[model samples]
Target chain A: MPPRIQIISILICVFLVAYVFELVRRRHLSEEYSMGWLVTGTSMLILSVSDRALELVSELVGATLFTSTLFFFGLLFLMVICLHFSIRISALTKQVRTLTQHVGILDHEKRNLEKKMHQAPWQTSDSSLEQI
Target chain B: MVTPEDDRAESVSYPEPLPQAPKTLIIIPAYNEGKNIGAVLDGIQKHFPEIPILVINDGSSDNTETIAQQHNAEVISLPCNSGYGVALQTGFLYAVKNNYSLVVQMDSDGQHDPANIAVLLEEAQKDDCDVVIGSRFIGKAHYKTSFARHAGMLLFGTIASIICRQKVTDPTSGFQVLKSRAIELIASDEYPPDYPDADFIILMNRNGFKIKEVSVTMHASPDKESMHHGHKTVYYVFKMFLSIFVTLLRKSPKR
Candidate 1:
């Protein structure tokens, strides 16, 4: 890798790791999900700091440039994360539909109970007696 | 051969205890059908005076809930616009909770004749039938539909018939009667949300549930837009085929 590229990547990796840590600390992200980001950031940091590691990984990835290997892995990680989000969204949609169905049915039941309370004379008299 | 106990045992088989009378609940899923809901409710109420009616208002922007309430039908209003399948599933869930033996689902567009409810229910009463679909194309009923819709229905119906080994004349019919098993199925995790048409029938058949069809009279809708208009037709076909294929790939219910 070029000298300038090495210095910039190291800085970016440091920033990414620190940001992920901050998010987890502030409760914006849970530790379980943050593990993926933290792992990516650490791996990038190690590659930027050690040229030997990058060269070996690039050979395995069959990339002419070591930086291309990093880009390829980063793209792959993003695709996997997007697919995970899609699955989570589908589950949430089903949950919302079920809850909406329950809400409608429960509302109907509540209205029926209220109607019965108003129609029954004894209940009305008992409420009036309590008020007195 | 001379033993009296052996003779008695060979001659007679004990019968299971009898089931109580089957109770029916009518579920109508309506979305902005305030214009036509009144007459549909009235027609059904006139025909079946004692049966309970439930109108699922799918977050209609119009006065559908008020109209259904005025007609003395139980109205449940979703907080937001869930699709047609969700509304019907809501009714099924309600039925399962309330101990209803059967549920008849109908459209609020008034296309389905209320008098046809009897034919569907009678078919569902059979021991082998779990679902009774009221088809407009069966028998000599001459109901007219748009060319595109008719073609789509024919294609899907043919596919369903081939897969299920029975003639399915109308795969997109919104009218049907579901027995207790079918009602519990729609409420369970087995069902998918939205567009419970041919795919649902295929799923149920694969799960060992019997599907029967009855000929019924149908009239063209007065106002609602056709499902096969333009862009929607493309999406409907693609999503429908994909779900059908996926349903085939999934592990079927153990009979």
Candidate 2:
């Protein structure tokens, strides 16, 4: 790679890596949570570097490396966001199931308590108390 | 037909005996606590041997499972480190499927006193509470947590209470006794991840389960280095708050 292209590649990699690190630091991305963003960031940087090597061919196609890189990154981000949403959906489903099960148990317990209350002799009207 | 003893018992209140429901299950979720879980299990076994203990080894690369198994605890090993929420919900699922009447969640870090486990059970059984959280800040005990973490917890608890429309003193307290229903409710597929205590508590309240908090002493963990500090702590706080906000926006399920 030429010195200028190499510098550009290095800068691109640095910017993307730093941005992802910032996401993690800001709690936008969790370190142990998932590998989606890291993969996306690294892959996008590689694509940017390769596209620069093909700059002459790309100029024939009237596309700049910067624009193409941004476009690819946008797609990568969308994919990661979609993955996150799916994970959230699954987690939410588990929460709903657990919540319903708890409700059912509570209902069952309430009914049992009600039955006991009705069956208790103390719950009945006492003629002996009236006599006293 | 009322003898002196029968009259005394009846005078106390209702005469019907509440059949001893299924035994309460104690769930200790531990990660890399090889040094603590064995002792914790022994302490619990010595004190409450009647109650079964189940340890959810949350993908510990250490000897967490071996320690738990050696200590006679029923072990449920997760294949990977799925965070505390997954480990806890797994315990709840186990409780529900096994027909346990109540479930107690205690950390395996040895910070939580095993003797205090009975207080949680008592609150659940006597008050008929759907959930009883062992609050470290509620009573006279000295809270040794960092100021930032303390403020974070208070804020989280207050917000959780408002969202759930119920009083929640220690929404993030891992030490809790949950009625079978409460356990089953949070074992749902949509259970919030990372610091799920608040969201799960709110979920119980939304489902009409009673929630209560009891003050308990909290001792510092012997392994201070085990704490997740710096950027990780920031991430935990950020994710926890975000999860709560997102959870609040979710529409409640129709009865």
- Which candidate ranks first by TM-score, i.e. highest? 1
Q: Give the range of the ten consecutive residues with the poorest summed lDDT in model 2 chain B.
A: B1-10
Residues B16-45, model 2: lDDT tens digits:
344875578898888889988888899788
**Candidate 1 local lDDT, residue B2:** 30
Query: What's model 2's overall lDDT?
Result: 0.70
Every model's DockQ: 0.70, 0.03
lDDT of 1 by residue, A27-121 (tens): 99988778778888888889889999999999888999988988887777777777877888898999999999999999999999878877877
Model 2: reference contacts kept, as a fraction: 0.00
Model 2, which residues run further than 4 Å from truth? Answer: A1-132, B1-19, B225-231
Cα TM-score of candidate 1: 0.89
What is each candidate's fraction of native interface contacts (fnat)? 0.96, 0.00
* Weakest ten-residue segment in model 2 chain A by summed lDDT: A100-109
